[model samples]
Target: MTHFGSNTLHVSLVALPDAVISTLAGILDVMNGAALMGLGDAKAQPPFQIDIVGERAGPLPLASGVPIEVQKSIDDIESTDIVIVPSVLLASGGWQKGRYPRLVAWLQRMHARGAMLCSACSGVFLLAETGIFDGKDATVHFGYADAFTTLYPSVTVHPERVLVISGLREELVCSGASTTWHDMVLYLTARHAGATTAQAVARMFALQWHQDGLAPYIVFEGKSDHGDGEVLSAQQWLAQHFSVAKPVEEMIKRSKLAERTFKRRFTAATGIAPLEYTQRLRIEDAKRRLERTDASIDEISWRVGYEDPAFFRRLFKRTTGMAPGAYRKRFCIPEFARS
Candidate 1:
């Protein structure tokens, strides 16, 4: 394993064929900036020695079809303080095991030798493939929660959390969603270098840390592909009639199954109960209206089938972790506001 001095941290970034180029570049730029900023202080040495390593040493094509020249192969690196795997473009089958056997082995070796493993968005799948995240809480893009859990039943998947620190020693860290490298890098910088240096780097890049996790942006569409024909029919009906008040009884009737069986099948297929599914649909609609319209919150609430405005407000906050007004202020279009 490579050894680090107290003054400098070595970071190895894994570049996969379908990796997001911007996230890779942004991480490098931020680490380089942190190193340079630390150099500005006479008392402190540079903070990071960053390298872009891949499974093979060559020009790798990114998701955007741009080619990035990797500095070295994963086999070339003996050890690093950290390994960052940026988001990958998931295949239709999702993350299949043994896809990158050598790379997975290298990651396992690095972690066994005490490297901190970090991933953003779908890159978490790569880490999960190494079996490092089993029996630990990890976060991924909210949209992938069901797929991820279904794939790795042992790992505790927290789709709504912005970041999660796993491992008994907290060596594995994960960030949620695309573009969450902003938080991952900042948090890493703070942990390895210092919070002060992290702040400077954040200011230098005009980066805004998402303190609210992934709840605010989640669009809660239920998963409907689980092959339960009766449950699928219920899902279809709910999609067309989600705005109706207390649609569960009708949903059960439509499914043509006993109440207990319908509830079980629905939750098994969708990973959520019927009532929560309806609430998610309503909240999703309310979020869109908040972003696109100037209607009062009460108006939007009633339009989405909430009879009691106060109850709607509470449910909105419970679902989204943001007040309706705050959500609008953050996401509202100026043209819509004016109109």
Candidate 2:
């Protein structure tokens, strides 16, 4: 949390196999750009010294198969003010145990030396494996939430959050999704360079803060791979008839099990209760309508099975972190925004 006064901040971005190429390049550019701002001369010493560090000191291929020359190796960097882990390409089976033991050990050592650790998107998988995030609140791209939770049950995963800060000194920072690196960079700038410089960088890069979190972008496809045939049938039925009156009751009846058994199985398979699943279905439908049409909130709510628009508004906001009108304003077509 030290500001850039006279000492130049050393920021290191970890370059590992499957690390995002653009993210490494982007962070290097932004941090260096922030350092050079208001220096009055091109040759002035920048406030930040940015380096791309890898396991080895050489060209490394990223997830996109593009090669970036590493400026330093992890062995060369004894310590740094900040260490950023960019999103990696998660395999179909998700984070593998002991796949990157060297990198995990390096992260643990750096954090022990008081280097702030930050990650974006699936990069949190690496940090979680470092064991620093065990008892802290963290977040990742919503699509990876279930897998991340399953892998690290000790960590508190807030899938709806856009940014999460936890650690003894609030140095363990994480951002949701890939593009959210913009938010993370700006936050880091503010933390180390002050708000004025952070704003300058924002204006320079046209970076906007994502204050509304990740709920609006989350597609609620309930867990359908849990292998409960009866629950799967009920899920399919509800998908087509989620807007029906008393849909949960109808689903329970169609499930052929006793109501208690049906509810238990549904929750077991989907990780959500039947009523909550129904609500998610309705909210997702309402979100689609809000984005694609100029329909009034009341009309959309009624179409999505809510009898009262007021109640629907509350539910929509609760589920997505934005009011229906606000969601529409943020995501609707350009013409709709202008109108």
Candidate 3:
């Protein structure tokens, strides 16, 4: 809203007690570097103005227990071109509702005033609190997708995406996982500064975009915290014998509940259907085997219960975003095999 030049965007990083300092530092380095490169003069004033904005001005300690001096408070910043909420160390209890009322209000005001707002990983949780992401597509760490979905059901979560750009005018930007902060900053640099400046900064930082997405990194662990003893027992049994033929049907029999009841309870407890649960267990087994063994994809597929190697390959690619051979090549440990 207060833009001065094509390359000049006022960038503000929100500082919170539980914020990840490394993410903040990475964005600062990339943005500053891009600004310097765009100006083409080390001595000239950088085109971009970057600041650490906190709830209250002064020193704020991050989750790392290190203090960072904030240059401006949320109250002091009336308008800014861009606001970045860095990733935070989200506790198991999750983002407490109404805990950051002032910050949330300020974020809404900024969005309403035409300032672009961005978040990385769990920072999306904070940004969501502002209601700016309602009915919009966003992304966060895959591990936290369920929690985020539960907390903000209105915001569709694409856990597998490395980045999601949404909202009216696409002013709201989100990046998945903690490290994708690099992608978000680079995107901002390319948009406000120039693609050339962004490329130079990326080269300097050795930053790479995670094009493979979070699927390859997600480990399928069955959710068992629900208070259903039958579902828990079924999950445990499936874990040991997922490759068995008609495993979901066998699990239903073992659960001792009616077919519909068992299916309902399993889906409720695991957040997936019985058949999907079995597939995940089998895929997890295949992943481990691929990581530690030199077995052919056909053999591994058969070992994991799928008789049709072609079907297994397709499923593997669908669930993991990588073919079996690609997964093996990426994850296999040559040192372990040698040992």
lDDT of 2 by residue, 1-339 (tens): 223456568888999887988777887788776655552234444567888888889988888899989889888878898999998888787778788888889999999999999997888998999899998999898888889999999999987888899988999999988788888888988877678777778888888899988889999898888999889888888888999999999998787789998888889889999999999999999999988888999999899899999999999999999999999989888973565
Best by TM-score: 2
RMSD for all candidates, in order, please.
Answer: 3.7, 2.9, 3.6
Instruction: List the candidates' TM-scores in order.
Output: 0.89, 0.92, 0.88
What is the TM-score ranking, best to worst?
2, 1, 3
User: What TM-score number comes out for model 3?
Assistant: 0.88
Worst lDDT 10-window in candidate 1: 1-10
Q: CA lDDT of 59 in candidate 3?
A: 94
Q: Rate the local accuracy (lDDT) of all candidates.
A: 0.86, 0.86, 0.86
Off by over 4 Å in 2: 1-4, 37-45, 336-339
Q: Write the per-residue lDDT of candidate 3 for residues 32-78, one digit (tens) a residue.
A: 87544453454444557899998999999998998989999999999
| Clashing residue pairs found in predicted model 2 | none
For residue 186, model 3's alpha carbon misses the true position, in angstroms, by 1.8
Clashes of 2: 0
